[model samples]
Every structure is written in C-alpha cells, then in structure tokens.
Target: MTLTFIQNIGGGFLIIMLLFSLIYFLLWVYCVIDVIRSNFKDQNMKLIWIVILLFAHIIGPLVYLVLGKNTKVGY
Candidate 1:
C-alpha cells in the first residue's frame, strides 16, 4: 500500500500531522524572535515583519528567510 494509504488506516496520519504542526510552530517562533532581535534598516520593517509572521502563518517565515535576511543590519 502507499504511504498515505497506510497513514490513513490507523494513527499514522495523526502523528504525521502533529509532527508537522509542531515543527511549523517552532519555526514560526524562531523566525518571530529573530525578526524582533535583528536590526533592520527601516525600524518600521521590524514591526511589519512581526505582523506578517503573525498573520501569514504558513509562508511568512519561509518568505522572510529567503527575502528578508538581506534587509537585516549584519545579515
């Protein structure tokens, strides 16, 4: 059977979802803290990033990592 099929048969699906949710929460917290502590060229950008992190949830941290790191004071 396929992995998804196996997962759906018992508790595997729940475990997988929970693991992913935990990882996402951890990443979100880390990114939010990083944004708070890092110095940005425009001070307001810090608040903006935090708001984005709070609202965007899934993709905010990812986009920030790929695009926002350049804007930090010392990278």
Candidate 2:
C-alpha cells in the first residue's frame, strides 16, 4: 500500500516537472526572439543580448526583460 502511494506521488511530481520545463523553454525562446527583433541604439547590442540569453538560461532573459529592455511599448 505504501509503495503504491509513493509511486503515485512520484508520478505527480514528474508531471509537474515536465510542465515547468516546457514553460521554461517557451520563455527562453520568446526572450531570444524579442532580443533579436528589438531595436537598440548600438548595432552590436542585440548580438550581445542574444549571446547572454543563449548562455545564461532563465536568469539571463529575466534580467534582460527587467533591466535591459526599453520601456517604450511601441517597439
């Protein structure tokens, strides 16, 4: 009985992990695309942002969006 209960909990945890992974991947993609499409004052800035996003994983994108991106909504 205890074994079955433990298995059920493990299955649920696995499903949750998969879901989180999917979300993380999608967010990463969106951040990369945004950095590519965005206009910056310096021509090389976009390249730098892309490199950061690619190598730094989740934290990279979050930091860029929060600190680096321009607040103007039009672009």
Highest lDDT among the candidates is held by which one?
A: 1
- Candidate 2, 55: how far from true, in Å? 1.0
Per-residue accuracy of model 1 over 28-51 as CA lDDT, tens digit each: 989999998899988999999998
Clashing residue pairs, backbone N/CA/C < 3 A, model 1: none
lDDT of 2 by residue, 1-75 (tens): 988876778777988989999998888888888877777777787888888888898699788878666632344
Largest TM-score belongs to which candidate?
1
**Runs with alpha carbons beyond 4 Å of true place in candidate 2:** 1-9, 71-75
What TM-scores do the predictions have?
A: 0.83, 0.75
Q: For model 1, give the 10-residue run with minimal summed lDDT.
A: 4-13
For each candidate, the alpha-carbon lDDT, in order, equals: 0.89, 0.79
Clashes of 2: 0
